[model samples]
Target chain A: MSQESQPEKTQTANFEERLQNSADQIETTLRSLLTDAPRGTEQLRPPKLLAAMQHGVLNGGKRIRPFLIVEVARMLGYDQAGVLRAASALECVHCYSLIHDDLPAMDDDDLRRGKPTVHVAFDEATAILAGDSLLTLAFDILADEATHQKAEVRAALVLGLAQNAGIGGMAGGQSLDIEAEGRDRTEAEIRQMQAMKTGALLRYACEAGAILAEASAKEQAAVTRFGTIIGLAFQLADDLLDVTATSAQLGKTAGKDLQSHKATLVSLNGVDATRETLNSLILEAEETLAPFANKADVLIATARFIANRQH
Target chain B: MSQESQPEKTQTANFEERLQNSADQIETTLRSLLTDAPRGTEQLRPPKLLAAMQHGVLNGGKRIRPFLIVEVARMLGYDQAGVLRAASALECVHCYSLIHDDLPAMDDDDLRRGKPTVHVAFDEATAILAGDSLLTLAFDILADEATHQKAEVRAALVLGLAQNAGIGGMAGGQSLDIEAEGRDRTEAEIRQMQAMKTGALLRYACEAGAILAEASAKEQAAVTRFGTIIGLAFQLADDLLDVTATSAQLGKTAGKDLQSHKATLVSLNGVDATRETLNSLILEAEETLAPFANKADVLIATARFIANRQH
Candidate 1:
């Protein structure tokens, strides 16, 4: 290998190590939280529901959203059990979205993370309930004292989460995506939808860190900007992978964008332009964190990783 | 009119008038909340999503849940904007469940409250998204400072809402209901499912009232018990309606329980037994509220309403 390639390879390896560590911590937290089944006379949450929830969440994924939450919170000096719990809560919402999106009525996906989807492994009704439970659990975690000592902070987290994951955010974006199918959409329209569907939660992950730290509004805005750029880059990377990566690499179907007529940046701008856009977005994301200097090195690394991930 | 029935007629009329007033207030609050469009550059929640949410919520249901929240809180000398907001939040969850349950994969009903179900009015995807949005919006409402002056109260409300509406509560019960279809379930099992599916939210509604009032633990427990008995009576009445009422009167399909092979209480026991059970439950509910005496007359009326609604 060339000498220049060695540094890049080492950076990639370091980023991967950091990500893996975050994923491991997140997994442990989530497993404990989701599996704390009802004890004694508490029989509201049945065993079947718990099993379905585990099937959806415990299925191996990078847990990237929670990683973002954890890293940002740590950078803001907000490393409490509350922060970790909040991160896990965010992951639960992400997992829930995936489970629902893969439903037959939505994406009709049979596989996710290289395994049978929740609706496939469990039944459709069970899958739906699991997703609903996970979504509700996210708020439950945020609203609890375990998530934050400050009621205001917990309230803020809950509000931010609901806004991001609700109509104007993820679900609305999804609705738009379904409507956009088989129809030509302007680049601006596609971008709007993408921001809502994907960017909102990513943006929330960073904003949550700020809320956890009780950071100034300016700092919150800056981190939000950072999250937004990376969020777009993440989508671009995903679109690029759709054309270039195999289903085995993705752990889900590849080339689905073209087949479903889904509007994506790559479909609108072509692979070359999309790659160029991703590169610029990553640079912007890096610049957004320049105020934090070296403290944001890991975050910058995360941006690059998001922009360049193979899966 | 017989002389004996004159006073009972007056009482029923009084209850209807009070319920109508509560329903009006809830409808106004929901409309304003749902239609408050984003200001400036914020465009996450789309108009279509908002419209769908309103369709599901603004329909002409009695808003019985919110009414319960209001009456109970008032009985406890806790009448504030927070009470109303919390009530609206609860109603949102109830409406979301109805929309989702009516989906083709579930009950597959086309009509709700004499109008096309959400999926029929819009599309399957929109209905799903709308329900998802409503569920999230409920937490959003509870977490806002406007919902409660105290952060702990807000946090507690969020926690309570999540616990009641989540896996161990509404969703878990829903899962059981679907799984129980075409399967024989003992009376105990059916009652358990009903408590989780329907009772949890109603239970939450009353508990919310007590929590908002900062009522004592014993008072809260008693109100919760009152809510539980009424919730069970509500379900039994629904089962009775399924067997007795016409589709036109109900505004949705009747005889669905038997058609779906659902293990409802009325199905497990005979209609006469179910009616007798409902009467005893109503008596129990009224007794549970006896501590408040005449202050809880409206709540007692609510229990009677649950027992006697023809549709």
Candidate 2:
């Protein structure tokens, strides 16, 4: 109501608008990439495979990882078209992970983003095929000459993506998480698992932006550090939300960690302590961008947004 | 014995020796690539995940695919170390496909190469993750500088691999294969499905070798044509064996295509006619390598080996 509060409200509102706009862009690009791309001269893709892939990717999500990629690229002055495809590739990997993680053998969740999970919407076989296609398509998109003008850059992107998504990264982390279910683990062990399971891809998104911009090693390292801190914050906020947010608000099953006896930061430190840690991590993330100062306003805001998000 | 029979026996002996030698090299290279690679600090891969992946890949079948990659690369005069990693990458993709295709949702097979299938040996979830890790690891190997001296070549290899392995290629073909179960399909339709499924990767392996060698476009096309014909031959041979070989010989469930009512070249044309067609295809494959003359001997031998194998 007061003048001082007005600008802060507008800033938050602006970030929301930016996030929505980026998601829209990603949706359009992803649709065309998935459906229209020629598999060969015959165009022999199974209609059902395409349907399952679209079902998993097209409907809804925050697109936060892609937004980071685009924002960081924008901050470094890369063309929108050049980076959008790359960002979309990252989203494909993310969507694939979610699809697989939600399978009956894994999380066994039925709801995602307020709708049926891919396996529930389609059959499990179709869901598995769809996930595989999406992951493969991510690399195909990056390898396209359209993603970047430099071959080295494209190679770097592919390499970075494969690293984060493979064993010792997201997939490896998921394996650890699965093993840790209903078991006790130290906080350090939990951090490592979370870092691989979720944090790896997030870090890669920022690193990809840096690669796109051809930033200096020093500058890339800074953005990467920023990415890592926010990645931890993102996990902390997610754990906090698991206990605090409702199923309706989260668009996924709520209180899952507690129900499944999954180890998490909130379980280890309790909610109030976890919140304090998340706040400090957000500040730490913001400080990592100090060299960029005004140019990094959106990124700093992104760190806070990640921490404070209710869903 | 006649004097002329001496050279014929020697040729067969030489081909057998060459095949064994190539398989040995591939097995050694694949083991090193899978076990020693540092994905990130501390080599944090879960033991089960690693176990599943290695079980799917190692101590396995003939290693025919990797042999093709290495032989083709050698035929084009590339260094063994430079091309072997790339060859191994393709084999990883092949192994991943086998692992997933054997899942209960897909072919529901319990055996592969006389050992329990990955899903049977491990749990279903670990098998899925292992397949995923292997697929991701393939791209990682290709993107590494060790695969090729030229970054452009590496990018091209990654793009080509993704294209063949994704929806328009192996996955698409698989979708069709799954849909075709218990259904009749025209010969043309069967060919198309086979081409996309198994044929695509075989084609990619040869094309990859050409790409690595920086061969002329015309030369690449010739090798690619050779790959296509052999891919067809490979499928025909497989279909024939499904009917003729015992489960022990095939190292998988025998007569599965018949039991599942899956369409195949043999199913459509009958065994006698299918064998004739396979022979013709092998000849066609050999003719495509005419440009290389004596340099093509190993490839020609490989084509015959594929068509004539009992298992």
Candidate 3:
């Protein structure tokens, strides 16, 4: 564990070579999926709202949620288009969350993906509507478009995503997060807040794909387990990076959780110990996927990506 | 028109009389449903988040959204508990919206339904999470507990509500609303904003019942139309009241919109003319329900309640 060996640049290249194709496949579709993606040529007004929405969703980001969504779709043997559509819909919700989260009342971050946050880029009100429209458009995608799959499965997957993203889940977690500020919370309470705030939707991004595939109860359980672990590990890594990574490296504001003094894994456990815990958790997650070894590589790669990435 | 006798006291009494019972009904279940709402609660650990969730949702004001939801369900010939349960989820979302809407960044209203806004009642961060949690809990209800319906139907309904409530529908409308302050938006734009802000969710409530009934395409279309008209007309009437009524009369606050210079029909049209337009819309809505003349008095009465009410 001597500074974790930085992947030796060549090994990093090799790892990118191994996973870059799949990652690139996801990235390309993500870019196109939002390119002037109008709701339709219908008479739906609010042209500016739509424009702001496109700006918010299309502003370049890693597209992590969609990548996971479509990866599960791909692992289940669906073609690129099918997965991309679902992935795009998920991206809409993800973008919506970020926009709302960036609102002055919420997390209040003014930059996203290395650019001005929606409110700052546009105006606060437009940013709000952009987020709202994106959210509604997400369901519209499932209901109106995102075809080729059974309506029922699409419906269930969309619903699951909504469930995880909403009040009792991610948004609620965020609320608790705001509440936790400047207050000493028990570790269990802190974990619960993080679980809801970050973990819930992250978990759903993985589970939604399996749900779309109509994966079996056993497969569903496995993916959920995988989702839960990745979600927590993802948050912890995020916490660690907030402490260790610079704003330039992380591509967003860093040390925010500490600035806010909100309870977080890093705040709960010191950075070095959190690093050890995160590494061990990654190993544990690998074990969780051992049963589906061949199909689990991307999922495994994603976990490692979150755990070890500089950003 | 000479103020049309101002409906004196009877209008409110009648409107309140119509919605009061349902409000009472929703209130009765408020505690039990939220506390023990979701059936399979065993696996949820620590339960504080859900408890905080229950804290946010339970024991609230008049259940206008649920009233509409259940009214629509009953209008279609079923008073099933399942429908009410499904409707209840929307109430949670609506409550969350109100809570968030009252936040400092949004409307910044300190009072909601004659009570302190969630943020005022709770901490700002807690209020954010409370609203966020309530929003998420809505979808979770349908996904986790509404065990009576087909997964597809449930998913569609849940997705519909979540999407509408989030960015594109309610939240988007609010953004436009916040932006349009003092900007002199046209009548059409004001109506469109109102439709999205207020009408979208109401429309979903009506549509949700239809989806649950597995209503025929034509019937669904008809119900959707009914919902659209009602939703629009309701907002129109509400705008009219904001001008005509005072804060005490309205039970929370009034004239806030006018004070903010937010565009409204009354703002565009003179007071008397706005009242006429609102009436015409109401008449059109009540007439639309004639096709379902024999189904449920509750629906007709509900329509009349909105069309002909004061406060």
Candidate 4:
């Protein structure tokens, strides 16, 4: 991002403005990355899957994961075009998850980011292929053309991403969410569920940033801590929104969690308690950044924005 | 495979024999790799996702992809755990694709390799997440572990796999298949479909073997040729089987392609034409090996087996 948006406060911005500014740049680059993607993806070369993927990945979302990568990279003072590549890779994975999550066999949703879901826009088969392709393409982008000369950092980035996205991370969380459907669970269980499903990817994002920056282990841990807390708060906010926010505003079929008989933070802890949890988590995330030597404002404010964003 | 049980001179020595031999060996050491899976992957892991993943991967199917990886590695005389690691990673991707393909939104398959489909065995959401996680985990297997010495090699492997599996490769093929659904398509379109979906991965598998073996670019191209032809033959056989085989014997739905009004090689070209094309392709594949100056009898036999296989 341009210096004007650099979060002058340096200690409290969570780099939201800075991150968004940088992320906007990354998104633009990502668009350039996609101008010829249909021809570029040798394995998934079908026009339908290409358009579906472009729809899923190119359609504007918050670009939060990519921003996190760039943010942490900046904190380490090591971001470059390489960081943008990693950010795009993370975006690809995140977009794939969204596409798959919206499938009829899964959440069965029909809309995403205020647009028709991939399955709704295309066919379910195409959506599944699109999601599958995006997921595969994400790693390709990260490993092939994404990384820089530092092999260790690249490996660390790939490892962090893989671990979070796999059974140990996003997959595990999603599994837990499915397991808890229609069943009441403890706050701890709910927390675990959210951590894996949502927190894991977010954590991966922060770690990718740290990795790109070649941050010290301690720094990586701090960012991880921040990611964990913020990810949970984000989930809690999402749950709360399901109850309080309308479909027109949220642009999603809210209250679907309840209709699915799923026990979210709102159902388990109630709106007020969930809000309290979100507040506490947000603070914890901010505090976690204290140990890091770099400017911690972007991550901090990112956490706050996640917790309180009106959506 | 003790070399004896591998495909040999006997006509009774079928692809199943070779596949089974490889499957047994890989399964024997499969658990060893899980030790390296993400540390927190199993904690609060989704039972539904796990079930779906296990259903697709652990279910009794011939580990063709893994076998090919090992076989190619063996051909290069690089007989360490690199081949196995690559095999495990390859299996993870194949399993992920199977899980997604069986979803109600995709192929909606109820059975695979003579077992319940992931969606049938578990819920669709679990299946989707399971597939997603498996895919993410494939990279984790490569990135988390310190198998490949050169990060470039690891990156290449990851890229190769992703390109083959992503929107342009297998997913691309699947997209074409979906688009062609209920419509007649030209032979070129059919070839493009098969090349993307099946050809991309097989070629990647071939290239992966060369890469892991540290084979030269020229050697890599040769294996790629073999893979391309074998992949086409494999798809042709699948098309033929859909028309000629019994569901009971095939271990899954039979003639479903024709029933669904989907076009296939057998549908586009007559059975005789497909047979001739299959022969020519296999011959081309075998000829690709000639430049290598090594006797790839097993690989050649492997190509021929692709043509004669029933299911």
Best by lDDT: 2
Q: What lDDT tens digits, residue by residue, belong to model 3 across residues A14-107? A: 5556555645665565455434333331123355666677778766566677777776666666553666666777778778778878887667
Off by over 4 Å in 2: A1-5, A36-43, B1-6, B40-43
Q: Could you give me the TM-score of model 1 versus the true structure?
A: 0.95
Tens-digit lDDT string for candidate 3 (B228-296): 888877887888888888887776779877788777887777778866776786667667777788674
Clashes of each: 4, 0, 14, 16
CA lDDT, every prediction? 0.86, 0.87, 0.70, 0.76
- Residue-wise C-alpha lDDT for candidate 4, range B1-311, written one tens digit per residue: 44566545453466457778888877655555444344533344455555566666777666767777777777777677767777878888888887877777678898887888877777777777777877877887777545577777787787788778877677777777777888788988888888987777777777788888888777777777777777888889889888889998799999998889888879878799988988898778767877645557667777777787777
**Candidate 3: chain B TM-score against the reference chain B:** 0.87
Per-residue accuracy of model 2 over A253-298 as CA lDDT, tens digit each: 8998898888888988999999999888987887889898899998
Best by TM-score: 2
The regions of model 1 sitting more than 4 angstroms off are A1-5, A39-42, B1-5, B39-42
Quote the positional error of residue A310 for candidate 4 in Å: 1.7
Report the Cα interface RMSD of each model, rounded to 1 decimal.
2.8, 2.0, 4.5, 2.5
- How well does candidate 2 score on lDDT at residue B30? 82
User: Residues A1-311, candidate 1, lDDT per residue (tens digit)?
Assistant: 55476998888887898899888888888898887575221356787778889999987689888888888888887788778899999999999999889998888999998889998998877887788889999998998888889999998899889988888688888888887788889999989988988998998898899999998888898999998987898888988999999999999899999888877789888999988888899889878999998989999999988988988
Query: Which pairs of residues collide in candidate 1?
Result: A44-B168, A45-B168, A168-B44, A168-B45
- DockQ of the two-chain complex in candidate 4: 0.62
Which ten residues in a row are the worst by lDDT in model 1 chain A? A36-45
Model 1 agreement with the true structure over B81-176: per-residue lDDT tens digits: 878889999999999999888888787889998999998998777888898889998998898889888988888888988988888788888888
- What is residue A193's positional error in candidate 3, in angstroms? 3.5
lDDT (10s digit) by residue, model 2, range B128-208: 899899999999999989888789999999999999999999988988888777778988889889999999998888889
B-chain TM-scores per prediction: 0.96, 0.95, 0.87, 0.90
